[model samples]
Target: MGTADAPVILVTGASRGIGKAICELLATQGAQLVMAARDGEALQVLATELSAHGAPEPMVAVIDLADADAVAGLFKQVFNRFGRLDGLVNNAGVLHEGLLGMIRAEDIDRVLAINVKAPLMAMQYAARLMSRTQRGSIVNLVSIMGVNGAAGLSLYAASKAALVGATRSAAKELAAKGIRVNAVSPGFIDTDMTRAMPEAAHARRVASIGMGRAGTPREVAELVAFLLGGQSTYVTGQVIGIDGQMVV
Candidate 1:
């Protein structure tokens, strides 16, 4: 068991990219983590690594975010094991790009199920746990595309946009109960998702950014760490852009 002061944080999408980065940074800070992802192997690897480095061995949950029941059970397990949850990072999401008219109903359903509904459901359960303690923080991983329209990513943008609105509304409703909710909108981060873009299209996107480069997952993770920690006690119901001035 972890010390009382050690925060118990649940992070979805913990297998790779930004999610992995967030887990790494928080481990260094001595947070007890519940890492969730569909990739059980990767999650186990991460859990072992964090343990080897002196952090508590993180609890790894293999879960498909599309299953609403599994999402709810994840929280139930967290509360049952840890006794309380101090933070939640809703980082699991899917990105599907296609012309508006060409997008299929199934694709839209898949994207929204993971990107929008899963996080919303996870927050619902996390809030229930936090309400009992009357304190905790929730950070939803939104996107810059959600704030600014992108031609080929209408479905993804719409889902993220909905999350942004939910973040604000949840913040208001939970603030009085000592829970804070916010979002991090990363712009053109160098993740596998962005790496798959055609070279020319990728260059054009990077060049358009004021920084002239794509942000690293660690950079985005740092912002998440700050928000989850005490440094941002006054911050809540805000959508912070980590796009290197790309969306300002």
Candidate 2:
């Protein structure tokens, strides 16, 4: 069981990249973690690593976020185990690239299911737990493509944009309950996946950023930590971008 002194925070998509960084930073903040992802092996590795580093041993919930029943079960376990939730990071999302006209119906459904529907459902569950305590924080991971536009990524952009609108609405409706909701829009972040682009292609991408390089997962995680932490209790309903000032 977790004590009130160490907040119980639930983070999804927590096995790699920005999600992994967020987990590391939050651990340093002394939070009791509940990590949810589909990769049982990877999640366990991270849990052990964090515990070794002196953070509370995280409770790992392996579930497919796209399944509504799995999502509900995730929350049910949280409530049953900890009986409270102080924070939530709706970070699970899928980005499939394709031309808008040629995209398959199944592809579109998959994108919306994980990107849009999962977070929406997670927010509902978190809100219920948060309302009981009259306090909590939610940070949704959106993208620059959501607000701006991207070729071959229209479906992904649309899904992220949906979360942006949802974030604002959730903030307003939950404010009276003392829960803050916000979205983090990352642009040209330097992750293992993004860095694998051909040299010239990567250079062009970085050249567009005023910082002369792509933003690191750690940089993105720091901003997310602030919004989730007590430091930014006054910040809510905003789409804060960490893009190194990318022109896109």
Best by lDDT: 1
Question: How do all models score by TM-score?
Answer: 0.98, 0.95
TM-score of 2: 0.95
Best by TM-score: 1
Cα distance off (Å), candidate 1, residue 64: 0.4
- RMSD values for the candidates in order, in angstroms, are 1.2, 1.7
Ten residues in sequence with the least summed lDDT for candidate 1: 1-10
lDDT of 2 at 31: 90
lDDT of each: 0.93, 0.90
**Which digits, one per residue and each the tens of the lDDT, describe model 1 over residues 1-248?**
35566899999999999999999999999999999999999999999999899897799999999999999889989988988999999998888889899999999889999999999999899999999899999999999999798999999999999999999999999999999999999999998889989999899999999988999999999999999999999899999989988877
lDDT of 2 by residue, 13-115 (tens): 9988788889999998889999988998999999999999889889999999889999999999999988999999998777676788889999988889999
lDDT for position 62 in model 2: 91
Q: Clashing residue pairs, candidate 2?
A: none
- Candidate 2: worst-modelled 10 consecutive residues by lDDT: 189-198
Residue 32, model 1: Cα distance from true site in angstroms: 0.3
